[model samples]
Target: MKILLATDGSSHAQAAESLLTSLPVPSDSELCLVAVVEAPTWQSDVASEHAALREELAGYRREVEERLEREVERLKSRFGRVSGVVLSGNVVEQICQLATDRQADLIVAGARGGSKIRRWLLGGTSDRLARHAPCDVLVVRPRDDSAEPARGLKRVLVAIDGSASSRGAVERLASLPLGEECEVIVFQVLAVVRSFRMDIVEQSGDLWEAERRQAHDDLNWAADRLRPVTPHVRTVLHEAEYVADEILTVAEEHRADLIVVGHQGRSRVSQFLLGSVSSAVLRHAESSVWVVRTEDADVS
Candidate 1:
């Protein structure tokens, strides 16, 4: 597997690096380290080309390059096939572009660190990276950031929604050759619209049964895909008003290290207008999250 890791040398990024050493990815997989140097925003198009501001950014870029060189040496000690690149521009955009250029199978990053304006793995940056990255993006919180120590990589929670999106998440995960010790939970929630109308509620009992049956089928399909990684696959079907909340609950109950989710492939504004489940999980899950998009599913 080709994995691209974006780090800023912050404590949060360090946690992500530490976690990477324990991940289930093959030891021989190619690992690329990327550090982005973000320049200050310009008030006008001409302002960006101003010589003074250009010189300042160039100096900062040199500092970042030095730091990246040190980090490369440190990480090389951990990763077998490792490389580093220093890019100048938007953090999220540069990372996304490099992932596309390198055809990375996954993009790993840490959350909430560095300057507020330049934090690469939270707020708008994390949201955009999850939605726009060419492949899966894994967001990890620093261990200290969590109230409880995260469980090991043995267990993972994958939320299935019976859509191409959910299937893609599972497919990407199954592609990874996780160790035999790994355990996977294919979890689904019965999401039925609530209707106060007695007639509508009574009429939907049969449909609810059909939904449960379909959930089982989807869970089985996910199980088949995951069995290659590990035989310890289990399925859970639940009904709740907030699917995201229940997903976290299950992950916590099972002590899952990672929560795998698929991008609904909806833009933020579109989701605000449409629906939410995957997005909510990405935002709220205290555990590490891996978001795979349908576009990344078939990337061999």
Candidate 2:
């Protein structure tokens, strides 16, 4: 396996590194520590500050390179091969291009975070990376960058909706080295219609029942498939008008360390859209998230 790990020298990024080391990553996997320094911009009117700005940017670049090297050295024990790179450009685009060039199987990154109100909102960089990256993305959010310690995740929640992308996420997650002690919850949120659909809702009662039964069966099948990864697998079914909100609520109730979701939703189009369930989860959930994509898309 190949992984492109992005860092911005934040406490959250350090937490991400600690989490990766705690996990049972493949022995022969290649790990790359990437630090992107967005090119600095200045206005021509600020000519007096040009020289000072240039010097400041240069010092920042040196600091970033030093940190990258240190991180690479630290991760050497966790992976068979480790390297570091310092790039200057759009952070998301650079990381995505690097993944495509290296054909990475996964990208691990820390969520953009802060204290108070910012805790629930994911930074734009991580969100865009998850949406456009060439491979799977793991967005790690340590409970508290200052108070919380780095540790392996014990419980994971996976949301599935009988979609191809959902199944793909399951398969991809199963390939990871989750210990037998790890607990996995295979969950699904059934959709419910309201308001304008009252007349049609009554007519589709039997159809809804059939769909519920199928969802239950699929949950069982998914749980069985995950038994190899961890015997502590369970299933939960929920009926709700909002899928993403339900997922977040369940994850919090269970205190899941990680939340997994498909790159695309059951409708396919909605997930690809900006406000899809997966996107919503990426933005709001406090837990770390893994977005898995099954099919290849144009990377340019």
Candidate 3:
């Protein structure tokens, strides 16, 4: 796997590094550690002052480079075939560009950062990468101080909604090497679209039946997709009005260590107002979430 790890020298980014150290990647896998020096937008009338700007930016760029070097050494001690890069630009843009330039298979990153309000108001770099990268993306949340491994996904939960995006997550789960002893839980949450109260009451029973059948069929399809990986797996069906709420509820009820989810890219404008579900999951879930974005999105 060609993995790209985006670090900002924050504790959140360090958390991501810790998770990468434990991932069961192949020994031959290549890793890229990246840090970006953001350019300030002040002093815009510098058409003739390019040299001055470069000189001013040089110090910050050097700092970012040094941090990248230190992180590279830390990762190298734990993983194989690692390299580092330091770039000057907007953080999210540089991340996408690097991922594309290197043809990374995955981009891994932290959920929250030192700038929590900025990230929450304007989706963080990790959230942006998940939406726009050209490879699979993994957003790792900081572990709860009280939560221990507890057998490592002995009861893995796969959230499905029968969409192409959800199918992508299911296929990814099936491809992973969950040892024979680990049990897989194929979970599908039936999303109930809200409408007029009369309409909801009129079709509640019929909608429930249809959703039940669809969940069964979806679980079967997901299981078959994983047939190449694990032959023994169980499927669970859940129904809830709100997608995020139900997912957290199920995770808490089952004490799920890892929640696998699919990401459908949302534009920056919409993300600014209503945050994406994946982003919400990262903030709210008690357990870690393994977000599976598009093939084009990197797993940072």
The top-ranked prediction according to TM-score is 2
lDDT of 2 at 4: 88
Query: Model 3 scores what on Cα lDDT?
Result: 0.69
| 1-300 per-residue lDDT for model 1 (tens digits) | 889988777776777777777786777788998988787677666855677777877777777778878878887766678888988778889999999999998888886557422544476666667867888888877544842334347788998877677888888889877768888999987755666787986888887888778889999999999998888899998987667788889988887778998776322112321025666776777778888866634321
Report lDDT (CA) for all predictions: 0.76, 0.80, 0.69
Model 2: per-residue Cα lDDT over 1-300, one tens digit each: 898888777777777787777777788899998887775456666766888777776888898898888888888878999999988777788999999999999899888633211232255788888888888899888875452434876999999988777888788778776887799999998877665868888888798898899899979988888888887999999999888899999999998889998887663113343247888888888788998877842221
How does residue 201 of candidate 1 score in lDDT?
A: 69
Candidate 3 residue-wise lDDT, 77-193, digit = tens: 666788998876677889888999989888887665542112321255766676677777776665564222343345567777666667888877876776665566777766655
Superior candidate under lDDT, 1 versus 3: 1
Order by TM-score, highest first: 2, 1, 3
TM-score of each: 0.84, 0.91, 0.77
Model 3, runs deviating above 4 Å = 43-57, 77-80, 115-122, 145-155, 180-183, 197-207, 224-233, 265-276, 295-300
How much is 192 displaced in model 2, in angstroms? Answer: 0.6
Per-prediction count of colliding residue pairs?
Answer: 0, 0, 19
In model 1, the Cα lDDT at residue 180 comes to: 81
